[model samples]
Target: MGNLKSVALLLLFTFFVLHLPFVESDWFINYHIHVTNDLPLLNSPPNQPNLFLHCKSKKKDLGERPMVKGQDYTWDTKVNFWRTTLFFCRASWVGRKTIRFDAFVADRDEMTCRHYHNSCMWSVREKGIYFSKNNATWGNMYPW
Candidate 1:
C-alpha cells in the first residue's frame, strides 16, 4: 500500500511539472496611438468626432475617449485566445460620415526567450495610419 501511494504522488508531480509550458497566460499589453497633424483623416466637415479605439479583446466597449492632434492615447487590453487580439479606431465626430481604420496591434509570434517590449506603437502618417509591428510599408493594412 505504501509503495502504491508513493508512485501515485510521483506521477502527479511529474505531470504538473511537464505541462507548465502549455498553460495559457493572462499577459496584457499597452497599445499607444499617436495622431499626427501631417496626416489628415478627417473630411471637409472636420467634425472632430470623439476618437476612440475599439478592440475585439476579452472585453469590448472599453470606453470611448476623444483624441487630440499630436497626442497619444494609451489603451490597456488583454491578450485573447491564441495570444492574438484585433484593434481598430473609429471616428464619427458628427454628421453622417463614420470611419473605421485598422490600428493593427497584435503579437502572433510564438513565445521567445528574448525580451519583448510587450507594447505596440502606431502613428498617424501623411498617407494612412501605419501599424507598429508591421513594417511602415504602404498598403500593409492588417486583416479586418
Candidate 2:
C-alpha cells in the first residue's frame, strides 16, 4: 500500500509539471493592439491636422504620440492575472474636441482578440473611432 501511494503521488507530480507550460501559455497570452490615423489628409502645410494619442492602463502609461494621416501605432501587452486588465486612450486633433475611449477591456476584448489571433485594431476617423478584429470589417465604437 505504501509503495502504491508513493507511485501515485509521483505520477501526479509529473503530470502537473508536464502540463504547467500549457496552462501558463493559455493564461499569459500577449495581445497586440494597433491604432491608426485614418483621417483625411489636410492640405495645410504648417497646420496639418495631426492626431495625438495617449494610451494607458492602470500599470502602464504610453506617452502621447503624434500621428499624421495613414500613420499607425502599435503595442503588445499581457492581460493581468485577475482578468481585469483595461487600457484606454485619449485622442485629440487640431480642431476637434479631445475624446477618450477604452481601447482594451479584458472582459470585452478577450474573446474577440482570441478569435483574431490576439490582435485588436483601431482606426481614428473624422466621424468616430472604429474597431476591428481582422481589419477587414470595422464597427463604429465611439463618435467624435
Candidate 3:
C-alpha cells in the first residue's frame, strides 16, 4: 500500500510539472502586436506612397502588406515553450530606404507585454518607429 501511494503521488507531481507552462493563466501570456502607419501625408505633393511591410517569425510569415497613412496591421502570437520565439519585420516606401527590425522577441518583450495586458503597439512615422505599452503614450524605439 505504501509503495502504491508513493507511486501515485510521484505521477501526480510529474503531471503538474509537465502541464504547468500550458495552463491558461497569467503565466502563459498571449501577445498581440499592432503595427500602424502614422506617417503624415505630404501637403505639397497630393500623392503619398503606401508603406510596405513584411513581417515573419521562424515558424510563420505574415507576408507583404501595404498600409496607407493612419492604417494599422495587427497579429497575435504566444511565446513558445523554449521562449525562443522571435518575429522580425521590414518596412519600406517608394523613395526611402528599407528599415528592418525585430517586431517581437520573446525574452525582450515578455515582461513589457505581460505588464501592459499582453499588447505591443508600434507606430511607423516619417522619422522612425515608436513603441507603446499603452495606446495612449508612445516612445521612439527605432529610427529610419
Candidate 4:
C-alpha cells in the first residue's frame, strides 16, 4: 500500500509537469487608445479631413477608430498574451499639418496593462502631435 501511494504521487507530479506548457495563464492584457482631434476644422476631404487610429498584430488589423474635429475617440483592443502589437494612432488626412502617433506595445505588465483607462493618448494640441500615458501629462511626439 505504501509503494502504491508513492507511485501515484510520483505519477501525478509528472503529469502536471508535462502539461505545464499546455496550461494557459489568465494574464489579461489590453491597450486603450485615447484619440482626440482638437482642431477647429478638418481640411477638405481628399486633402486630409480626419485622423485615423488603427492597431494590428502580425499585420492583421485588430481594430480602428476615426477622430473627428472637436471631439474625443477612445478605442480598446486586446493583445495576444505577450505578443507585440503595432499601434498606428495617427494618419494623414489632408497635408503635413496633420499630427500622428505610431506606438508599439511589448510583453510587459507596465506596457500591456489589461485594465486601464486611457493607457495611451494620441492627440493634436497647438498644431502638434502629442502622446501620453495619461491625459493630464503630455509628451511631444511629432510636429504638425
Each candidate structure's TM-score, on Cα atoms with residue i matched to residue i, is 0.47, 0.78, 0.78, 0.54
Q: What's the C-alpha lDDT at position 75 in model 1? A: 58
The worst-scoring run of ten residues by lDDT in candidate 4 lies at: 109-118
Q: After superposing candidate 2, which stretches have Cα over 4 Å from the reference?
A: 1-26, 46-49
What lDDT does model 2 reach? 0.84
Give the worst 10-residue stretch by lDDT in candidate 2. 40-49
Model 4 pairs in collision: 47-94, 48-93, 48-94
Worst 10 residues of 3 by lDDT: 41-50
Clashes of each: 1, 0, 0, 3
Could you tell me the C-alpha RMSD of candidate 1 in Å?
6.1
Error of 3 at 51 (Å): 0.5
lDDT of 1: 0.46
- In model 4, the Cα lDDT at residue 2 comes to 100
Cα lDDT of model 1 by residue, 15-121, tens digit:
76765444433343343433322235456334453344443333465455655445465555554545566566664333333456644334542231112344445
Query: How many clashes (backbone atoms < 3 Å, residues ≥3 apart in a chain or on different chains) does model 4 have?
Result: 3
Better of 1 and 3 by TM-score: 3
RMSD to truth, every model:
6.1, 5.1, 3.8, 6.7
lDDT of 4 by residue, 1-144 (tens): 999999999998997686554333322535666657665553445334365555455566646556566556665656554445555554554344444456545444335333345276666665577766656676776776
Ranking by lDDT: 2, 3, 4, 1
lDDT of predicted model 4: 0.56
Encode model 3's per-residue lDDT on 73-143: one tens digit a residue: 89988888677889999988546657998889987887787667799889988888888887878888888
